[model samples]
Target: MTTLPDGLHDFLAEAGWAGGTIEPLPGDASFRRYFRLRDGERRAMLMHAPPPHEDPVPFLDVAAWLTANGMRAPAIHHAEPEAGWVLLEDFGDDRMRDWLDARPGDERAAYEAAVDALVQLHRLPPGPFAPYDMDAYLREVRLFTEWYAPAMGLTVDEAGHEAAWREALEPLLARQEPGVTVLRDYHAENIMLLDGRSGGPQGLIDFQDALVGHPAYDLVSLLQDARRDVSAALEAAMLDRYAAATGAQDDFRADYARLGAQRNAKIVGIFTRLAKRDRKPRYLAMIPRVWEAMERDLAHPALAPVARWFDANIPGDVRRAQGGKIA
Candidate 1:
């Protein structure tokens, strides 16, 4: 067993969970780590985010907003922001991925619930999260050149890449409708299915990176997942549902395609960096799926220039030539 940090023990004791047993939970791509705490029949989640690296402020703020808006976010039982320890409500182990794996036939209902949660969230008044504007979008995609390019033993014309991306993406940016709270990572893995929750059936996690952005952004993130395969049929259905529910379906498909490409491009770089720099190669296996999704997004007529750039530089054969291995 991994030894518990002294501070964690102290924090738990201060929070009156002193004798609770700690069991490490599966971690995500971030610096934060989660553990389940059990004291007799009571349970809670402990989030350990080392300071100077990861902060709990955003998670705390977003959780508050989500709960306030009638969505199901984990309640904060105790918080020690300065020490980077937070005790959160245990939403149980019903992550959407695991739930779907166990009941393949229920995929549609699960996705519908997830989409409904988004619809409710979008209805809420916008919060103070940072804008996911063009500058931020461009900044994120640079990871493609910064990490993925270097790992594939290829050189990138950084200036040329950014300029081209700007040209391709600016029009889409200009066409964006008013923004909503975009939970930067709204895919299945971060969503919890609360079987009997009073507010909503879906619970959101991993939203510290939330931003106020184009309403289509989270929808893109949901249907065009990086780590998992979301079928085209389900994706289409969810898009239709969101559009019909929100009445902002005007040019929604175009926005979805544009943002999907941008996001997958960023993921390609991030996953590569995780393997080569962070020494976590498991993320590499998901690259091909992300690349495939990016290709689909680039096929949109609006992305012709971006598509041309990829064709000129990382030809299809060469891009997939890595054969699922980053090293």
Candidate 2:
């Protein structure tokens, strides 16, 4: 197994370095690690990604684009090409989640700020830097059936459920008129609560996976969060907010509900695969809430067949698998 890189501390120190206070930070996902440094009043972050997994090129490109688009993603100060190591701008881990959660009722205001940030992000021109095209979106949508379906231990159900799901995905996919460069995972976790942000949005991080997708996908990510539940009223309010701004109120409910079903179904398979194959059990607990969201979204007329498939064949067997009796 390849170990993580030694980071800037050892890299610079071994060369008789004289500046930067370095300290290793905590809470890295299973695949990566990070550290922070204070160098002559300038704060920076060091990310270490070991071999067989680590690649920094995408992060560099996406961060540059988001920064250029008026978002405060940290700048890449230095890097070691072959080592899979990089020194990046330090946007402290003051995530929107933590800041909003502490303030209680302030969740609405914080979420509004988040929505505004997203609006600005989604309305920007898609440059060569932000290449979110149909091929990529289709491939990503296929992951629901490609990886997640098998992970769920369903032996390819009759009526070709996967095929039906794929069929359902087409109309909505065709309706997308790409507005802005989409950051695929625009949620509270990836966004930082900047100290003094003056641009079009808040600080952004971990946006290497940015893609051009249906704008609704990110909106679904924010309102239909897997980690925490935002209430129904607020969720509706957000939908109205985005619709009014875009003037696309033509069945926004159906649109969001369809998108929500698509997202939640994809996540179900993903969370299961994570627990079973990747050994990431934490995601499994979040699956139930996502399932509930799917159930609600599928209530609309557009998702009748998709909802029927779930109702007849599967109503969350994972919960039963976890020793909780199915109702």
CA lDDT, every prediction? 0.84, 0.68
lDDT of 2 by residue, 179-263 (tens): 4566666677777877733222478777777766567778988899977879999988987888778776565567677778877
Instruction: Show the colliding residue pairs in model 2.
Output: 132-212
Q: What is the Cα root-mean-square deviation between model 1 and the actual structure?
A: 1.9
lDDT of 1 by residue, 238-288 (tens): 899988898965477877888898899999999988888888988888888
Off by over 4 Å in 1: 174-177, 196-200, 322-325
TM-score of each: 0.95, 0.84
Q: Give the worst 10-residue stretch by lDDT in candidate 1.
A: 318-327
Per-candidate Cα RMSD to the true structure, in Å, reads 1.9, 3.9
